[model samples]
Target chain A: MTETVEGLSINLATVRQQWGFAEAVEGCLRHGIHAIAPWRDQIAAIGLDQAARIVREEGLQVTGLCRGGFFPASDAAGRRAAIDDNRRAVEEAAALRADCLVLVVGGLPAGSRDIAGARAMVVEGIAAVLPDAVAAGVPLAIEPLHPMYAADRACVNTLSQALDICDALDPPQTGALGVALDVYHCWWDPELEAQALRAGPKRLMAHHICDWLVPTRDMLTDRGMMGDGVIDLPAIRRMVEAGGFSGPQEVEIFSAEHWWKKPGDEVLATCVERFRTVC
Target chain B: MTETVEGLSINLATVRQQWGFAEAVEGCLRHGIHAIAPWRDQIAAIGLDQAARIVREEGLQVTGLCRGGFFPASDAAGRRAAIDDNRRAVEEAAALRADCLVLVVGGLPAGSRDIAGARAMVVEGIAAVLPDAVAAGVPLAIEPLHPMYAADRACVNTLSQALDICDALDPPQTGALGVALDVYHCWWDPELEAQALRAGPKRLMAHHICDWLVPTRDMLTDRGMMGDGVIDLPAIRRMVEAGGFSGPQEVEIFSAEHWWKKPGDEVLATCVERFRTVC
Candidate 1:
């Protein structure tokens, strides 16, 4: 449980290019990884029933469904539509029996600079969809992205900010609303340890790991694999564990130029090796 | 004073490619800009004595000396060497009679993964030079770079973290240490307004203005002109004002592809125009 790869989970984005939903599962299974976090596209590729069947048949643990938050919009109608889409995503996460639906709560609307407004919309959208998520028995995991993604990808860009939202929406420290703490997005933060401690075990829903490359080529897809970059993985892993979240350290690299270019087996093999040694 | 260009200052890096020290000073003067911040290289190019003479003769108000901190280093000798260089930079800043010596406190050292250790080095390095800075009567302005630069640029990535250092080093609010708050580096922060309030008048040494472009091209360079990007300039200016600092809002853009390509006069003209209108 403490910086051990025994609980390693692959957030399928790590080897997304080399394998589809079923194929990726096989790859994880081959590497003795029983836990995975798959994106919506992967679920859609193979029908929802088939994806669910695979989960049941293989007895694999779906750590999280990636993801379900783009709440901000230009207007009320658009906002309503986003909430509806989020509800469907919650349903899908439920079908997949995902532990939580990770929310990459979106950034500013197109041609808009009102980040506060966007953030409010994110809160409202999440609140609007909270009922559906609760009814479906699917916990919501707010995944605060890297601040670089603050403009276009996600408004929630810190563990503190995500935990604030969770506190507002589900103040009881219920497992209903929590945070997916990704070291790649948060290792630079000075307040990270304090925020992780504040989140504790109950609100600490998922633990994602990836390295932040020094000369990060592309903002969205240039994530480094474990031990490949500058993140103090063991340090963050220790912090997460101390926070009392004994969840799997989900490897979620989005390295389009590097890891994605490798074969699925090679990627999984490397992940396993790194999981044992570095992470 | 209220988001007006009447107190506008331009950092020379905005048009570094277009002009040398003397030429840039002449260009700024021609645009009715009486204030500027020049980098060390620019000062070194034209002898420091000549540069200081030019500054005095033109009656130019230097808002800040363009940077004096890259403190983190691999070993004791390396760190000691950095502290010595910073002492020299403090001397230069005092020679220029600048308001503050802006410190872009360094990131992780070469082949190092200890961000906490790097941060400790930053603190120790700053503490090492604090007495010299005080003697020189040059306040050390900690310019917390954007988080994206945390690995290779600067570890101090938040106003709060910088302020903590300030509190630790200069607890009496002696104005010996403070922050150069840049909109481009900090616009995405949710705690910006609150932290600005915390900085108040004494610790807010310099106000830097630039825009955060939607697709920030290069992490180091692709900065936008004030009106060209998505920052809420007026709102931040107001927050800074409310925090008790009514200093000149310095224009500092690092647009390698766009603004840097323009003529010095043209860049100065546009900065003047944008300063009056948008910033």
Candidate 2:
């Protein structure tokens, strides 16, 4: 009989402070979590070859690679370098057999106030990488980060905006480009449900799960666990499912003060419990 | 000869830490700023009658009232109380002959995770008060706060969203139901220019100015002065002006640690200087 952890994927960042790539894989196995999304740095620490070996041997599912975007740069050379790096990211995701390569398309360039210009650079950068991504058989998932990160993190801050990019690039919903919809980033949007429906299964490449704490202390690392915050995880899940995405809900918390300090086992166990209950 | 501070208004909250309503007015005058926006608490501290007297005597242009909208409530009684409070706010704005009454619509009620419900409550709440607002001749400016405040402060987080509400309530683009376009709250919106154009002069009740700091220390307070951060203020001003709003750009910085600690004169002087230059 094949043992499978259905509908749950632990994003390695959830226990980043407590475990390395190998340790996290082991921890997830112990908790019966058979799927995961991992950051590039985590893959590098274990070596891409070793990570791929582990995934293959254990029959583990790589939900999505953490990222490959940050395309905005002040100079052409810098922008070219970003595109080159993104191509490498595509190779890694292809190696891991990831569902998609998640893209956190970058925010404003240094000393630049032209957000529209920055956004244009993101689209151009993504287009440059799309051919490489398609050739590698790795779908690119544009993760629309929370608007608060619009200044320093990602310029693409809405599902509607991400879909617009996908339509611009792919045009035919070819599954070559899609969006990684995280509840934390998108739950507050009034058009979220409509956008999710518009994305459907074809464009909804990944479904990331996390909560938005009421008094979110740190913008970068204060994300809440499944049931701890204001986000209605089950409701968001329903919307994604209605949109035809029946994939594992990836748990991607970046809690610097709380979850990061806990034991890796404890974190995995909590995620499993929440996945079964609240999520 | 009559003197007017053209294209400038000091939201008293900028100098709130150092001056009360009366003193803030004096400080603005000292800096040659004739227009001002004051919070309800500041007006209460000096008595509304007294505040009105000062506004009348000094020939001050009351640009806007600080706030008047916290409509979401778990129970009908609580919601009713909010509506009553909003009515009082309308009366206060009327008494002061202010340009508009800015509404920071409430977020989710306690222990509630339904943002959609909260949003519905916001529209209903606004609709409930529209009659009172119209009766008092006090235009209600629905200020779409940043998405960071969507969970606690305001659910309306986009110009498009706010305009949708305005269209729902008053489809004819009446000046009574409009929006206060604050750069600090809305500078990141993808459709800002389009929405500004949609708002035009009639729906653009007020124009607010401030900057967004990159590594924002606090979600509530750490707003930057005009030139201190990444927002393209002059570009935004041009958009607003193109939309036909040529009102004084109200400077509303909520920098608790920085501007709040400065002397009132210095804060006002800085506001004037930045307003003239960066803004």
Candidate 3:
């Protein structure tokens, strides 16, 4: 299929506040959207079997599980906990038959100034959980967040850095590990297009779509809708397609005060419209 | 002269809310510190010629001017106005016998999200004014801001990006253009040490120091003083020194609520104390 983005999926975080998992899924189906990426919390709320059954019954493609990262901590015990959680997440992805488990590699450890050290912890944590993920047949996709999140959110904040970690851990360029390229996080990077090309096929995993809002009000939540913001979507999509990534451009807006307040059906319809026209 | 931090200067914007330029100078002199950097507004308020004379009379070194960036705008007239104002800033730097004109390359033009294009505009803006700066012996210090400011502040957000621009414009690695490596901006980067090393002596125009607060309250203004936040100053300073940068670590905090409320002399004294112990 040429994939004109009409077949594009929406990550339910785009309308998280308006609907629970079941409601959001129903909303997607109502709008002729048949694929989605759901956050872990959403899956838990709907129950794993039900969520999985919904997918099988409706033939909805589970593009990716919302997360399976945050792999950094102050101590071994905390890191082990993260790893354990990641294992569970991988199992969930397997149950849902998700395309991949997206990872948001964590930021600095508590009371620590060493970002490099935190990064090391992330690597070690991922290595600890890699076997479990591989056993579950769930692909792990490291999502590089915006650099602003380096302190509190995820330190893997560039496509190059995330790909570097993937290369380090999966040296033979195995399909087990890859990167989830999000346009909002990397739209400003000068080496972005080059890095996307470097990602190639085996290492290119999931693609998330959102726009970077100018004068962003909240550091964490104020994400603009696809066409409303300044990202050249077609331009980035072209780069990804050239890299042979034909997956969904999952609409993963973290807009707490905007889209979250709209009707779920309305939000899904808008996402579909934007995906067809702008994305 | 083995330039220990005893020779390191403090840019009072780090503490300007706490002190005027005159008071800051007096305080630095009290601490046996003889070098400082001041913002343009401070000079305007205290009178520019008088600010120049104070530096001459007190034998204080003005390491570099605080700023002269903000290149992107909604329209050509606005951009032209910014460039014209930048030319004036270069003149002011020359007048003060400052070492360089620090440029915080501006972010997206209003209502636009093309960061690559914004970066292009920055290079063009600098090229437009480079001749005047060169003629006046004022090197342009490209201060790559933290990525958090990519939307409203400077879009040049990494040492490598800044160095790339410098390479493009000043291919010979001349003293005409370089970078102001603030530890806060580049600390999270895995490539920081290498990039700083790559910057080398000639291209290392300025070295601004401040701690990266963990919470980082407000995106624009909430900077922490040395030892009060999480960045390992001595480690980065080691990298800069290893890279052959022999300039003073100019303290440049932008704490709107904290240091801004303290007495001018107290803030200067704290800066000196922090410089001795932490920086």
Best by DockQ: 2
Each candidate: what lDDT? Answer: 0.92, 0.93, 0.86
lDDT of 3 by residue, A135-174 (tens): 9888899999888888888988899999888888999887
Q: Please provide, for model 1 over A1-279, each residue's C-alpha lDDT reduced to its tens digit, 9 standing for 90 to 100.
A: 223236989999898899999999988888889999999999999999999999999898899999899999899998999999999999999999999999999988998989999999999999999988999999999999888889999989999999999999999987899999999899999989999999999889999998989799988889998999999899999999899998799999998888899999999899899988998
Candidate 1 wrong stretches, greater than 4 Å:
A1-5, B1-5
Candidate order (TM-score): 2, 1, 3
Residue A119 lDDT, candidate 3, scale 0-100: 88
Candidates 2 and 3: which is better by lDDT? 2
lDDT of 3 by residue, B148-173 (tens): 78877898999999999999999998
User: Best-fitting candidate, measured by TM-score?
Assistant: 2
lDDT score for residue B117 of model 3: 77
The CAPRI-style docking tier of model 3 reads medium
Chain B TM-score against the true chain B, each candidate = 0.97, 0.98, 0.95
Residue pairs with clashing backbones, model 1: none
lDDT of 1 by residue, B140-194 (tens): 9999998999999899999999999999999999989999999988899999999
**Whole-model alpha-carbon lDDT for candidate 2:** 0.93
